[model samples]
Target: MKRKIFAGLAIRELREARGLTQLDLARRIGVSPSYMSQIEANQRSLSGTVIIELARVLRVDVSAFSSDDGVRLAATLREVLGDPTFGGLDMTQQELKNAALHAPKMARALVDLHRIYRRVEERYRSLDDALRASDGTVGSHQSAFEEVRDYFHFIGNYVDPLDRAAESLADRIGARSEDSLSRLSHHLETIHGISVSRHSTADGGGFVSTLDRARRTLLLNDSLPQATLAFAVARHLATLTLSDEIDAVVQAASFRGSDASAVCAATLANYFAGSLLMPYQQFAEEARRMQHDIERLATQFGVSIEQVCHRLSTLQRPGNEGIPIYFLRVDRAGNITKRHSATRLQFARYGGACPIWNIHEAFETPDRFLVQVAEMPDGDQYLSVAHAITKGGGRFDAARLRYAIGFGCELAYANEFVYSDVIDTRKSSAAVKIGVSCRLCDRSDCRQRATPPFDRRVTVDPDQRNIVPYQLG
Candidate 1:
């Protein structure tokens, strides 16, 4: 309320940041330095002649300092009505601002409802995560896509025994992630005779989707270069090496839904393939030998960039763990296709990611590498590097541009990766502190903001001019 300007201190901070020393400011405002200090120190009061002087000096409107919002809410109405963006709409700005102030609770609820309408899956995932960490049991999902992402989150993106087996293969054959993928494919073919094949999307969408209930044929697509190779490899391993164990894990899970079963099955195969490529002993040996250079590992194994990225996502296998990695794949438009985590990243399951996030920036640079150190709202620092790789045919006749893979992990283990060699470690991880979207991110000082979270207050009145839109107490 203007009658009770909640942020006289905020005004002082603005003055200081503008490089005006208290004495200099007092001289310009024709006030004693002692009086200015008293205002800042909260010893003297702020009203009337002082408020007018402040409005004049600070270049703010006199009404902002003189009247409470309840009184000036009518005046704030003018600024909103005059806004050209609302010119075409039937509602006036004052009506909008008054609705926003007098009943901000309703305004926030309306905003939230609109956001959910645009992206329900993300909200559902948030709810699911809240329920997961709170209770031991799982909650029902309102969005199928969210359900899918939530299901994957629960597994920590690691497949147990198969991953171990893959690690063993890594020791015997090699620890190259690509090599592991190739060998896993070979192992699956040799052991199960369940060959990989491609299918039309019209017939049945993907490898993991189509299961032969009649024939024990585990139909899979090899067209998907990285995950697919490892996938079929893991599939063979599951049906062959860890058949009983997988059956046990699946049975014990008591999970329902065909899609959920398919996802779990894919996860199991990937775990095995990861193990074969990095076999615990061989991987640990090569990881040390290569010093965890991800590019070098991909080169050594003759695999696509994403394969190596996906393999990095599986470094967590309990007793013989590797550096934990979090991998996210987003299209040029920043739609996340896949997310694998061995770290504490509560990524949004649906909707566009924050524009400030490095993943989106990586798209513009295309083939070039981007590395950034980011801190979350909760104060956890993470090291992230991203680059794009071709996904479709390379023929000028039919080739499609590749999607970028944004993969990185917490800084605590950054020393183990190839990316550790160059990035300046001195700068505060300031630019990296990004929130999801406003619906989820709760940062108090963002100016490129679209809307505040449902809980944040509009720190300043529209009638009251502040450089940045809001002031937080």
Candidate 2:
């Protein structure tokens, strides 16, 4: 069955951004003005053929019509409405979908307002502690981070100008050569007059890399791996050479305050660094050849495994896109430290992830890749791969940070990933049932549930001795 796409709001906005009228766009896409108006007014669904034509006419990626954002927004709305504060409201799935697809700005505003309310409520609950410990700057700082995160999400995690600039810089500096690190160091010293130096761990003060602008020197920790040292150098080069491009993106973003702007600039520099280290076209081609093998790709690109996973997620280069994979990093405490998705799988925004996920189990088997065929409540199945990574601890006394890096594409793309070759994606019964989070899950019979469904009524019966004590209504 073909999914109906009612992306009226997006279409209208894109048309207006291009300064095209209904008639003009209709003529360009070989459709009548009335038909175009109907399509933009949510009265009609666009065919796949027309969608391609529209993409070409609008000069945007065909993925512009993908329902991934709407799915994510709907999941967010579900989580928000599942809050006990809104438990009395009888919001239907269709209603939430409508809001997500038709009025995303309003939906996002509601989510933002709820976030503010949550923060205020938390502060109120601990008034004395908050008053004594916080200078009222924490909320703004956290809000700034959230704003920057959403900014990246809105851009589909692809910074085109910065990416292009980094790719060009990579080619000019011979980033793919066997002496890539040396080439980068030479470029930095000769072109930018910045000498690179490596310092012993004892003298580094736990810093990975430190730049002294006055001395034009970059001091890196000698304890760091070769790939990490190269990455740090590439990141510094991005900050220097791609400053103008980064500034343009930040300026155009119109973030709320200077804090968010600064964070955005730093994040864009990181994106540029990743692009430079793994130039898009070459990396994508090699990734395909390597069957999206994380270890092999990391080795081929001279980068870390986590870096390879992250770069794979950002392969949203329009027509040249790789598999639409979602990437996340979770700590031992189940807190998602990093997340980005180009697929339909949306991570929880407020609470811990589903306990059944293999990401959590990865911690038990260190350094081994754990694969799971999991299905969401919406029946979307994924071939997820999780590997536990330990960083730091260069010395025995240094703190070792443990995190699990998980990335996956939809089961439909399972053939492209080497890890999925042993699994049977065709068996629906084999897929473990998982949800975004415990609070929003509707799986009433789940014995592993930590909490009852937020929006459902529970009936507790003493006489009943089921796996769960309470029956969900």
Candidate 3:
């Protein structure tokens, strides 16, 4: 069974652009006016013969009907619209489609403008009393990093061309062997004329992998688990093999500077590595079969739990999309370390995550999976699972940073995940009330409220004190 491709909006746009009426184009294409109307309105998918006739009569390439440009533009527009500063400004899907079809340049311009606005706002957000007193310019990379994050986020965190190319490379090199790391190393050394080496100890405490381009040697930290070592090698191989594909995405981003472009490039290379480790189609099937058990998927793919969870979030490749999920990582302090969403649940941009969320508790119980059915202020519910992950500090004296990784989807998708089997998501009393963050939350009765919301009035009582003395009005 093949999925149908409907280009009603594209057909209508092309016909109107060519100064042809629906009936006129229908007659020219040898189709009924009613049928043409249905096609133009996207009420019907065009057949092969109809597409050919449409191309011949319209005197335009058939690609006009199957342009990914419209899809990309719509994605950018959606990201631009999702800015918190543009809260309450809603646009319908039809309007977004029209904008992509008819005013792509304008749509891009809006995205660019929003990017600039966010950068300026970020500078202000980072400005402190000391910086202001000293008249020093704020030096924050949040804007640039957030731009790169937004680029991946709006694209649904999947780079199809790179992903497919990686899959092909994996197939060519026979990467499906039980000994994945050995096979991958052999492929790199034989096919790409690159030698793989490992560092006795973690280099500089921060660098995971480095490539000496002149020597053509890939150096990996020996301390990394086999999965991470293989991933590092895969990332380097992707840079070598898929440079053009990765560069194309970077070019399309129109990043503000070389630093931002470099970040985008690194992100894409990592995406390729993840996709290579877990080929999209096979991984999606296995995930569904395993009920999205991260540990099982990790063991099957010979990857880490974090790697499995991250790859699961990228299963949004159009027709092959898996269960839509949101992936979030936070430090013990509740600062969001990494966040991506394929669902409606969005993380806070400027502050700590909500205190009531189980991700916070994950820090207390390291390596133990915590499950919760949490309800947001808007009444949206999710089945969240979180566990703490510790990285680095192979030696006892070295610094060990602890972070919690959380991934979940809406209640509608609860049944599709393994963790939700033991929990009752349908019970209203079982749901834990949560919010985006303390400052952005409006839950007045929450005992865990840390601070007053930005838009709400606070009544401070001098004499009264309950769970909190301040009333959010």
Q: Could you say which candidate leads in lDDT? A: 2
Write down the TM-score of every candidate: 0.58, 0.94, 0.78
Q: After superposition, how far is residue 363 of candidate 2 from its true place, in Å?
A: 0.8
Q: Report RMSD (Å) for each prediction in the order shown.
A: 18.9, 2.1, 6.0
How well does candidate 2 score on lDDT at residue 232?
Answer: 84
C-alpha RMSD of candidate 3? 6.0
What tens digits encode model 1's per-residue C-alpha lDDT throughout 100-218?
A: 44454455445334434534444356775655655633333333344345445555556566665655555655535545555554554565565544443333233342445345355
Please give the ranking of all candidate structures by TM-score, highest first, separated by commas. 2, 3, 1
Clash number for candidate 1? 13
Q: What is the per-residue lDDT of model 3 for residues 267-306, given as tens digits with 9 covering 90 to 100?
A: 8999999888888888899999999999888888898889
lDDT of 2 by residue, 220-250 (tens): 8887777778888888998887788788899
Residue 122 error for model 1, in Å?
Answer: 11
lDDT value for candidate 3? 0.80
Q: Which model scores highest in TM-score?
A: 2
